[model samples]
Target: MDFFSRQESARRATARMLVYMVVTVLLLFAAVNLVLYGCLWLVGHHALSRSVWWWHQWTPQAILGTFLLVAGGSLLEWFRLRDGGRTVAEMMGAIPVDYATRDLAERQLLNITEEMAIASGLPVPSVHVMKQESGINAFVAGLIPEKTVLVVTRGALDHLNRDELQGVVAHEFSHILNGDTRLNMRLLAALSGILAIGQLGGFLMRSLTGGYDGRQTRNPVTIVWIFGLALWLVGWLGLLQGRLIKAAVSREREILADASGLQFTRNPEGLAGALWKIREQGSWLSGLHAEEISHLCFGESLNMQRWLATHPPIDERIEALYPGYLARMRQRQKNPRPAAPTAPTPPSWNPEGTLGFASTTGRFAAPDKPLFASPSPDEPIPFDGVFSSGGLVGRIGELRMEDLESATWLHRQLPVEVTRALQTGTGAKAVLYALIARFQPMEPARLRALLADRASFASWVEQVGGQMQSLDARFALPVVELCLPRLALSDAGEVTGLLAELNVLAMDNDHLSVFEFALLKRVEQHLRPKPPLMQRHALESRLQPVAVLLHSLLAFSSHDEAAIARHHHQLMSELCPSPPAIPDHGLPPLEALDKALHQLRSLNPDGKRRLLDLCARAVESDGILHIREYELLRVIAGLLDCPVPLLQGVIHE
Candidate 1:
């Protein structure tokens, strides 16, 4: 499925999961109430004769109390987890991966992660490592797109080669792209209630029997024991259902992620290799919270009944990734003797900068030059082609091997100074300040005041600003993306300071330059908590914001005035058949445009897809793509929550 279909399916699955979760809770309520009714009948509060119904012993108040107890437990878990991926990772004792890390394995993880982020056309999410874990496992976590994070275990890095590790990272990113992180977090919250009930039972059984609390109960120990045993039994039943639900949901997603990994790395053997290692050494973790997080793992984290396993069998996964893979492995194992050599093994992925992908090369084992080209900012690009509008829209939310190469190529093109600057929080904000300063020439004093008042801070911004002197316009988005994780690490005061200064700078000019707009707007989207996810807003009622967005986007295009006007007319006609009267204010200010983008984000997925379709049509009218148009297109798409592929494949043939 494409991005749109996957998004819609995720929404449907979430809805169904909620229903199942609620039904499970209701069943728990019934079981507990029946237990109470039996206890009451034994005490002779009511007769079980035909004159009185058995449910009479289960009072309305008791039913409401049990229901409320289960609901409250679930709600508490949701509250604890509402903060997004960071909260989830912290729960599992994951340490964040710093870009400046000295360890080679850690650095490799960062590089591979950035490559995948570029492929998915999203910001590079925060990466975390479970250093103590020997399991070859990983998972993504987050409630929203901007808050998502990727995590991997130490064993994964140690055991897997570049190809196998890259394949593992690709699988986790597929979770991020497929909206599985959000769904997985929600499932975790839902099951917390069942776990809580079981714990409550354990507590009662211990407390009443002088286990932990060490209290001697002299009155009615027999009744108390019966009640405690009943709660314990019912809680165990609830846990059974919870695990069954988690297993059913997690199994299918694991297979889907493996398939996506194959698409992304274009090396089935890489993922198959990872699975084979898991088969040998196992993927189970010894972390304190491993059981709680098992369903979200890349490999099955727990040994359980086959019917209740969270992931498919390792051999099954290997076979799925490469048909007859297990049998071939057994055949090789049986033949211990040296066999006659036939064909040399192909090299693992090499991120060497190569133009005209696919036709020019097949084997990437050994490249003559450095793995990638380190082009000077002034160096000419070998290709500058148009977006394949008629066909490429489907590339959104999809990552491929070429996309990974493009990501690596883009990473290498950056000057070392800029890459280093992006590693820190303040330096990242300073880099943005530098990019914004480049938008409109400002006097030295004015820029100093707008960027920072403190000499230490202002000097840093100016230093990074110097690095921007040789920067190309095409690199603007990348700089912003690299800044995301760092910016996320910055204090709220720093983020707010950056935003305040940006608005002051933007307002002084009274115009939104294409580069500045994309730069600042993306930063704001990440720092500011997005409005709650809601899809109830109708497209018909949002025509005006749609118009404002279209106008602001076209104004940045490299097309001639006549062509721009013609494309606008065609788009507006298709977008609004009846044509609601909109203001004729040629182009909106930066603030208005920003507002329009946010408003359009709530459009139903299909509505947003059509808007992109019309937007692509407008670009097609120009018959070519320019850096400004490309950035504007991405900015618009990001605001709509629809990510496009990075500037690599589309920028070439």
Candidate 2:
């Protein structure tokens, strides 16, 4: 299937999730109404016949009971969120990511991720290695686009070579792209709510049992028996509801995900090989927490009971892929096709071919030698610009008028030297601008400088851009970012490393200013996503005001204080509805921010900490937590990760 077909499939998956949610909501509503009506009938049947007071007198009590049921359900959802992280952590910890007292299997995990990202047109996800298990298993978790985590068992990494690992990553990426992750998370939340009903019934039963005494058991004990019987029935009903949801929907989701994974990779052998290895090494995941994630595993994580199995039998799955393989196994038949005797057919295009010849063709004319030596100026940047207007062509119409209009705006008058300058801080702005501009042309002077700096062609873009009239800066930036993630890391150690690099770079030019440092922080923020709780509009709004302040500090203070305030306020309001009112000090524009920053910097050792704290407070100005706000807070926190908050000791310069 093409990209659009797969996207349509994902849409169908989303529709399925919505349908499940609606059904769940309807069932819960009906069940609660039935329970309420039954309770009201028991209490009001005699009262209605007497008519001593209004039969409507019992309405308030009935309403309260219904409210309690709904509140109980809401509480369950809250409880799951509170408990989810710990539960997942404890399960993961059971199978440690350490082999022979090592810190983490970082290299193998990273290699797999890099290969997978290369294969799939997606961002490389965060990688986690679980070392205790020798079983080949993997799983992915996260709700949003940014926070997805891809976890692999140590056995899979150590046992499977690079190709097999690539296969596994491809499978996980398929789950992410196909919209299964979101559906699975929703199911978890809904199931948690349904299960809470059983817990409530159990709680009531325990309380009643504890309150009963010896004398109460004898006289009119039938009421107590009936009450106990009702509680038992209700608890069982709740349990059954939870199980039915899991069995009916949750189990089938795995099969769909597996099929989707196969469709994405377009190579059944990748998965089949991994599965075959699992069987060879004994497919038992040796971890205490295996049961928690059993349903999400590539293979069975736990010993399956025939009735409660989430996944179909592995043999059946293999048979589905390799038809008649099971029959061959049963009959002990020999393979019809001989292995390794014939060479595989090659693709039509060969990379080694000359310019005029096709990629796969071996024949090349001698006249095309000069063309190969000095290729034409307009060469396509392959596997680049996959996210921009050029990449979106397949999804929408190819080269539409609106797309051209937008691409024209992206056209920059960048110098070719800007590519080389991107390696250092000197030409970062020009390169960044050029990158955002799709149709940018290089100036003559910039091209000459790039030709002179041929020795510093650190990456493919620099080398190619040096000779070309125009280059795909959009593609090059992401490639550089992916290849050099330390350029992206905002951890304390990483910050220190960057500071050292800056120190060396500024040896001849003297000290780096606060403005430069702030710019670097901004760039880093753009590269990484913030934590869920901190991602908010308030934080993004805070960026515009802060950006303006930084520009002013860099000797560009043309706008008045009122203008600045209006811009800041406008940004904040855009980010959050009903933004917190800003108090007017009637001072110069950005004076408050300048003062706070100066005070923060003068603290020397604690300067970074103060800045982070200030940023956190600024991000929460709207009094509501958002994901963007969380991300901004995290970026600032990373800039100051070194210093811990002190107790009695005041931080003075």
Candidate 1 lDDT over 1-653, as tens digits, reads: 88888777677768878888878877887787787777776666645553233266465755786666667777898899877888888988899997666566777777778767876887688899998888889888888878888889888877776667778988988887787888888888888877666667677778775222347633565677777788889888888888888887888888888888899889898789889888878888888778778888999887888898999988888988999888887888788668533222222233331111111123332335533344554543432333344344676788767667766666666655566677678778777777777656555577877645477777776777776777766567877888888889877887897788887776667766777788778888888758556555667778888777666566555346676666677778876666544337554555677777777878877777777776666555545555676777788888777787765533311
Query: lDDT of each structure?
Result: 0.73, 0.43
Q: What is the lDDT of residue 592 in candidate 2?
A: 41
TM-score of 2: 0.49
**Model 2 stretches with alpha carbons more than 4 Å out:** 1-8, 21-91, 94-106, 132-135, 158-162, 205-208, 211-214, 217-240, 243-256, 263-267, 276-295, 300-309, 324-653
- Model 1 bad stretches (over 4 Å): 48-54, 210-218, 335-392, 439-452, 505-510, 558-562, 586-589, 649-653
Model 2 — which ten-residue stretch has the worst lDDT?
644-653
lDDT of 2 at 7: 39
In candidate 1, where is summed lDDT lowest over 10 consecutive residues? 352-361
TM-score of 1: 0.88
